[model samples]
Structure formats: C-alpha cells, structure tokens
Target: MPIEIHQSDPQSYAVAADFLNVADVEVVSLQHEFGIFGGNAGDHILELVQRLRTPLVTTLHTVLAAPDEAQRRVMNALIRSSARLVVMAEKGRQILQTVYEVPNEQIAVIPHGVPDRPFLDPAMAKHDLGLADRTLLMTFGLLGPGKGIETAIHALPALVRNHPKLIYMVVGATHPNLVRHEGERYRDSLVALAADLGVSDHVLFVDEYLSIEDLLKYLTACDIYVSPYPNAAQITSGTLAYAVALGKAVVSTPFWHAQELLSDGCGMLFSFGEADALSTAVAQLIEDDSLRSAMRTRAYARGREMVWPSVAEQYLDVFSKVRFERRSAGAMVIPFPASVGEHDRLPPVSTTHLASLTDGVGLVQHTKFAVPDRRHGYCLDDNARALLVMSELAGLVPLTPQEDQMTLT
Candidate 1:
C-alpha cells in the first residue's frame, strides 16, 4: 500500500501503521533511505514504526559517518523501534557502534545480493555485443554527478594512449531525480567533456535503463569495471557488488563498500576523483593479463558468499529468529531455582538439540520441532550464543561421552 509523501501526516501514518499491525506479518523488513520516507530526515517513519505491533527488521541503505541533528534523531528512533538492524557493509556496523553507541548485538552485516552467473570470457560477451575488436571499460548505474562519470571520462585520454583500442562504456540512463530537475544536463556535460578531451569516439553512452539480463550482459562484455563514486561514506553499492560477483576486474574509488569488498587483492582502488590514479590503476590491470585474471579469480571466490541464494538464506535466518524471539517474549516463563542445591537436583540440559542444529559453518538459527532447519542458514549471533551456553554448561556438569564427541565435532 502506498502512503502519500506528506511531511507531517499523522492520520496517514496512523492508518498505515494500523493496516500493518492487522496484516498478520510475521516480521516487517523495512528498507531505510533518507529521502524515501516523507519528513525532515525521514523522521515521519518513526510515527509509523512506533505504532507497529509486528517485529521490525530494518535494512539501512545509507549509514552516514556524520549525520546532522535531524538525521541522527530519526535514525535513533528507528533503531529503538527495530528488532534488528541490517547494514550491507561492516563499516556501517562500525559507525553504528562507535558513533551512535548502538550495541553490536543489535546489528547484522549482510552483503548486498548479486545474481548467480558463471565466470565467462569477456571476448565472448563482447563479440555478442558486436564490439569484439575494441577493449571495453564500463561503468553502469543511473547517471548522475555523484557517480563521478566525468572522472572516468577525464581518465579516458590517458587510458586510450596505452590501449589504443580502448572504449569506455558509460551505461544506464540519467537518474530520474536528476532528469526531473536538470533534464539530462548531467549526461550532456559528460558528452561535452568527452568531446573537449578529444576522445569522443572512445566514450560510448548507452542512455537507457537496463533490466538485470541486459545489465549482466553489459557487465560480462566489459574487460574492466570502474566505480568512480566520489562519496567516501557510501555504505553500499549494488552495482559494485554485481561487478565483483560477476568476476570482473574492478577499479573503484575508496568508498566504504569498495574499501571493504575490494580489499585483500580482490580488486583495485583509487582515491575519489583522482583521474590520474584511476587511469593508472586501470592501465596496470589492462596491461598485466595475469594480474587481471588473478583479481577475477579472487573476486569470483569471494562472490560465492554474496550470491542470491546465500543472501536469501541469511534473510530467512534473520526473519525466523525475529519471529521466534517475538513468540518467545509472549510465552509463559518458568521461574529458576534459587539455590545451588536446588539447581543440582535438576537434570543436566541435553546437548542433542544444540548438536543437531550445528554444522561446520555454525549453529543453524531455527528448528522445526525436533529437526534443524538448514534453509534458515546460520548467523554469528546464534553461534556466539551457543558458545556462551556451552562454556557455562562445561563448568556446571561433566559432559557425557556422546556430548563430548558432539563438542569435538
């Protein structure tokens, strides 16, 4: 259901909240971005969330290192209202803990999801696109000033000087918001820049929004992928994630996501807006076939964890845990024995259930009656909880032979 974007619509918020409360959702996953909700810094979201009766799992799309007063207030309120907070990058988790003083347990770091695709030769895809002869360098996503497309365009002259057949592909249409106000002015300027730099033929702009199939096609066709975003605090980037997942050799600016994902030799990074650095990195990767191939191999290996299936399981785990916790919160509680002797009289807790749920990765997050639910996958939180329980149990009672074997496993 759609609610009108009015900054202070109390009745609208209340109605939306009431609808959701009665909708019988097990858990609500909210995607939080600053401008999406209506309010000063999206504070209007607080009104609706405050009225929610269902468990809330908020996925924060943007986590600012330095939030203004209004943004901070809205974020704090949202944090209080959410059962769990999700961020796509670890830097976001760090910022929430350090800057906002949020407890680490409240947050989960899940990478942005990417399509499951095979690592294929760029030549095959380039031939399919009728550009087999030229070396392709691509940057995709909605075209806007913040994308730093001009830097890539500026770097084109230096890149072309070495790889004479190089063609920089600027894919994707102008951002709707930018088009609404500026009417393709940003696209026009990039074109003009290319012309002025005397590399007009080397820069190609595919001015249209692309479907995932087409996006992947373009991605596969490119020999080198570049993300020149100038914002250092950009916490997540779906395009960047896709590039890494598709095994494309990447050269990106040091945005938060890039800094984390591109680390450990998975990809290359350059300072934001540094055209010379961008050109150098791209040239280095292009010149050294082994280096580029190794980067692709490492990136593909890392992408294994970020694939859609793995990410979906992670989300299911979070949702299942939230629902379980909510159900548990309202259930009857048994009072514990007061004295040590009283506790000693109680039978030792069985490790059977815990052992069944645990696999090599960690403890699975949920179970169906007596069976472990592997579809829900595992999470760090549950593993930590299991460790704590086992530590306490070891001190309280000697493990049975079977339990000892389970623990060793």
Candidate 2:
C-alpha cells in the first residue's frame, strides 16, 4: 500500500504515522524544529516537497505569526496546495476558515487517538500497580507555568486534608527546544509551589520524560486525571485522551476538546481560570466514588469509537474527496519520487512568519496560571526527520520492500 506524505514537523508525523499502514513513505524535510533549526527553512526541504509528483495531503499544525517572510510564504503556499485541511478539533478548523479563509467545506475536525489500555478493569490495575490501598489522583504533561500545575497544587492541599491518603503524579518535563521558550523555570516553580503548599511529600515529581509504557503504568494506577491548563489550545491533550481511554474520572478547566469529551460521560468540567471552581469540582469527584465509576465506563466506550483507527478513516476520507476535487479542477498530480536531486530553493516566508507565533501564542488562559509527545528527542519537528535519516542509516525502523498502488479518485 502506498500513501505518499510530506510533513513539516516530526512530532506531528509520529502521531500521523500510527494511523497509516504502508511500507514506502517519502518524507520531505519540513519537520525540522528539533532536527536542525538554522533559524530558517532549509532548501533541501522545499525542493523535497515542492517537487511532489502527487498532490500532498497536509495538516497545518499551527497558525503562526513569524518575521520570517520565507516561512510565511511557504505556509501560505502549502495551505493552498493541500488536498484538504485535517485538524484534531473544530476550533483548529475554525481558525483556518475564519482567520486564514480556508473554505469551511475543505476542513475536517478529527480528534487525536488514545491507544487501548487496561482502563476498563480498575480493580485489576490497582492490584497490579499496588494502588489498591491509596486514592491516586494524577496529572501528566510537559511541566510549564501555563499548565496550571500551581492550581492543581493549591487544590491538592484541599484534597489531601480532606482525604490525606491522596497522591498526585506529574509525568513529563518540557520539550528541550521549549527550554529556549521557557526553561526549567516552570519546573522549578512547580516544585517550589508544592513545597510552600506543604504537599511536597504527597506530590511526586518525575523530572525525566516518561516513555509511553511508563506513562501507561501511571495511568493504570490513577483514580483521577486532571488538566489544570490555563490555555487549552496549546495543543490537544494526549493526557486527557489516555485518561479517557482508561475511563479515569477527569477534572479539568474548560478547553475545546475537554468540553467535547467531558460531556460524553468519561469526565467532568469546571469553569476555566477559576481556581475555587476548579477546586470545588475536583473535590466533588473525589468524595463521590459512584460518579467516578460511571465516567470510567463511558470513557472506554468512547475511546473504542474515536481512537486512531476511526480517526484515521476520517482523515483518509477527507483526503480522498479533496484530492478528487483538486484533480477534477486540473490541479497537477505529483507522482511518487518528486525528485530532491537538483532543486535549490527557499520560498520566502510571509512578512508575518509563523515560527514567530511563540511570542504570544494565544495560550489555551485559566487565571494567570502558569505548559508526543514521545521522548524521540527531536528539538522541534525538524529533529525527528534528521533522526529518521539516521535511523535508516542505522536500520532502526527497517523497511520491508513492497509495492504501492494509488488511485486518484
């Protein structure tokens, strides 16, 4: 099977790769945030993707405001070139439609996926993880001020004093590149806040990034998963997805996906930016064991229907339709192996470049709260592609030779 793709970032590719079942994938170097950010786009990348013989089906990862004119120009061209726009939530699609003027008909909102886990059997998980005796409340993600760890921390003292047996586990550290964005300052701040709250002993902080297995182990042991994030749109929450998959009761301030998923019975929501409200809702769930039980049951059922397999189908369907329309309208079709052999070019970014978006990224804001997610260790999306090249040289992800067949319509 052949589904030719040319993505700009590695983290996005990693999530996208799981849904695709194919042997030959041609990656253009656009995914370079972590690989090698020269503070600019590389010509090898442009030549790699621009020469595509088949129309590319791309997912616009963000709406940036950058100073790099070249990046902006490329982004503009790329959006126009895509067969269809694929996003994880409707808000992302709306951003494209209202802000970028991407026609509403051309976008599809397919939320991210959560892998199957031992969520349905809490008793067995508790026994396996030795959490049978304690009430485990957990929150996992890149630890930054925007993540609202402080809010959860403040809420924790309330939780623990009422039920002293509770424990909260925070899982991963911020991305290495984000260190440029805001370093260990956020992590250090959380540590200090916990100490001041005097819940230092009760709160477990693991500084190293956790593997998926390590993450799952904690999920299995958790009774409640919280997303105290001030900004919801920083990115969709895999933490939330994982918790929902296992059916753990979720207590979160309102975020886009949270609002959508919470109502389905897997979790509950509190008003965003209000710590007292956040605290009260969390307290309610902890004291009421029956509600937690019901939320868990619904979450598992939702996960079966919305996880990667189903989400991938929606993507595939959108790509098929959009590609058909473009082809019908005489959009040139790029064949496999759109050569990277000779082209040396850099399409200038917009006067308003996107990479600059980090300056005032509309944080997804709970009060003045102070952040794949895999530890593949790429600096930005770029680092992953470089690693891909290295892996092929080292034979990490070995290719099994096979033929690919594509039908335009």
Candidate 3:
C-alpha cells in the first residue's frame, strides 16, 4: 500500500521476497523512489500484480499527483484496478473521494500506530541526550515544502523572545529528491529564514539518517512536539505517533492528522496555517508547566492505544472482511459487469494503458501487447527486483485491447 524503503541488505531482502510468494493478495505500493523500494522491483510488482489469484489491495502511501509522473501513473493504475485503495487519514480519504472522485466505498482510512512503551521520564531522556539545559521543541519528518517548516520557523521568532532557553530541534534530512532537484536550495532557504529571525543558533539541524535508538533518544528527549504542517492531505505521520507515544506536549496545526491524533488532550491544536496561533500555543505550553504536564499524560494514553500490534490488527481485520466478502459472494473473482463497461468509455486516458484482472493462476482474458506475468510480489521497487531474482519466482485485459480506460463503478 505504500513505500517500504530498505537502505541496506541482500539477505534482508529475502523477507519481502518470501512475503510476495505466499501473500493471499497482491499488494501494490506507490512511491517507489522514497528509498522505500529496493530498486526497480516496485515497478515489476505493478506488472506482476496482474497474475495473483486473489484479491488486490493498494495503499497510496503519499499524495500522488503532478511532480512524480511515473508514480502518478502507477497510482492511477492502482485506482483503476479492482484492488481497494487504503489511505491513512480521513482527509486523505476526502481528497481521493471528493476531489479525485474515487468512490467512497473504494477507499479506507487506518491511522498509523506506534509501540505502547512505558515512556521514559522526560528529565532522564533530556539529560541522556545532552539537552537538559534547554526546553526542546521538535518537528521531525522529512523536511519538505508541504512539511510546514517555514511556518514553524516563522512562529519561532516570536516564541524565542519569551522562552529564551527553548531549542528547536529540526529533525530529518532534507528529502533526497528535493536536494537533487534544487541542490540544497530549500535547506539554504530554511537556514536563511532562521538566521533572519535571529533564531538560527537555537535551531539544531541533525543532518543524517537517525537509527532506531537515536530516534527514540531524541524523541524521548523532547519536552514538546510541533507538527506545523501547511498541507492537510498528508495521510499519516509516524512522528506524530512517536510524540504521543513518548507523552510529549504536542502543538500542531488542526489538520486531519491532528484531528485524529489530537483527541483526548493528547495535545493541542491551532488554526490551520496560522503561525501566530502556533506561537500562542507554544507560549501557552511554555508558560504553564501544569498544562504541559496534563497534555503529556493524555498524550501517552492516546499513544498506548496506537501501538503497532493494535494498529496492525486493524489491517488484519480489514483483510478478513475483504476475504469474507469474497467467500460469501461465492466467487473469488467478480467482474465489473458489462453494464458498467460503458463507463470505461465515459472518460479518456491520456495514453493507451493495459490492465488484466485475475483470480487463481489463470489468464482470464487477453488483449494488446500485455500478458499477465503470473507472480504476485511486494511493492517496494529496488528490493522488488533484487529480491525477485533471489526468490526465483514467477495477464490479459479483454477484447479490442480494452481501449476505454477511465472506468469507475
């Protein structure tokens, strides 16, 4: 459903290869390049998903449109497929539903969950991380345009005058593509803005991929977590979960993610895209330690409910529901009826595309230059290719090459 990035491993790749081999359904993940996929394997999954003899489910991990053309094509293909689309936030569901016009029933929302761990004492964590002297305010995520760092930086100018000891930890490296596309221009812009605001020295830029332990140490060290997201369609953010799990006071924009996460004093929210309001929230947290403590307590409770096992079980339940529906319907494969076939011609695709739907290891139909590859695989790209080679594993659309493309039923 989304990118699963692997930085290293030849043998570690086996786990994914093994998964695709036995999975009851073909799972296609979009956004192959976020270091989520091994290599070209993600692309191969798109071709291989056609051969799976079971249900197909896709997770559009990120907003897929414009900028990334190839990924956008894959996302469109996923939507066009019989596979169901899984989104992470209600707002994301709204985007695909109201804006993209995907059927409401076709999309699902399941928030990302964190581990249910006993939170480290904030004092202990701060001391351990050498951050004891200062109040920590953090924004952790791959820094990018939609990430809302600018708003966070702008809010900081006013915030620092009142709470001089406060340190803003800017976690996460600039996104790889962003660096490639603009050559550290975005990073320079952020640095300049911080400098202009006279809080550049207070901003800590940890410019490396943090390991799990490093991540936890820094996460636990924070006194407060800030997610100043400007764009609201972002489906889910793992940092948001991590913050709540650690019981840190959270101050965030009232985006859909915050709506789902900021419930139960787990944190506080400000108006969307308002820097001054964000400043006010931070000032409130800093000025009132009692309020911060109360928020921290509630944040941990929310995190406890979001542990990975619990969240993962939700997906398992969804899978069970999908499987049960197929079984009760008495057929594993249900065609999109000929009556709805006219809808395929209602709209036009920019290019001629091919799709092959199947159940079991069979070529149910055939047309054009495309044929089903017959091996269902994991969606991560690079690993998909390298892993596929090691695993040593393994369609047809219809009459007239199925030229009518945009079909929704």
lDDT of 2 by residue, 1-409 (tens): 2333344544433433443324243322122221332224422234334445455666544444322676666555666656556666666776676656788776667777777664555556666866677777788877666778777888877777788878787888776867887777777877898999899977888677888887887788787888887865633566787788777888887877687777766677776577677668777887887887787788788777667788768767776675566454656777777547455444432312112221222212122212122222224444344334434433433332210000000
lDDT of 3 by residue, 93-196 (tens): 87776656789887767666676668666778888878788988988877778888888888887888888888889888888878888877887888999999
Evaluate all candidate structures by whole-model CA lDDT and list the values in order: 0.89, 0.62, 0.68
Q: What is the TM-score of each candidate against the true structure?
A: 0.79, 0.65, 0.65
Would you give me the overall lDDT of model 3?
Answer: 0.68
Positional deviation of 87 in candidate 3, in angstroms? 2.6
Q: For candidate 1, give the lDDT of residue 272.
A: 84
Q: Rank the candidates by TM-score, best first.
A: 1, 3, 2
Best by the TM-score measure: 1
Report the C-alpha lDDT of model 1 over 1-409, residue by residue, as the tens digit. Answer: 5444355676677687888888767898898999788779987888789999999999999998899999999989999999999999999999999988889888999999999999999999999999999899999998888898888999989888878899999999988989999898889888999999999999999999999999999999999999999879899999999999999999999998999999999999998899999999999998899999999999998998999999999999999888878885569867885777666586858788788787766788889997988888878787787888877888888978755654554
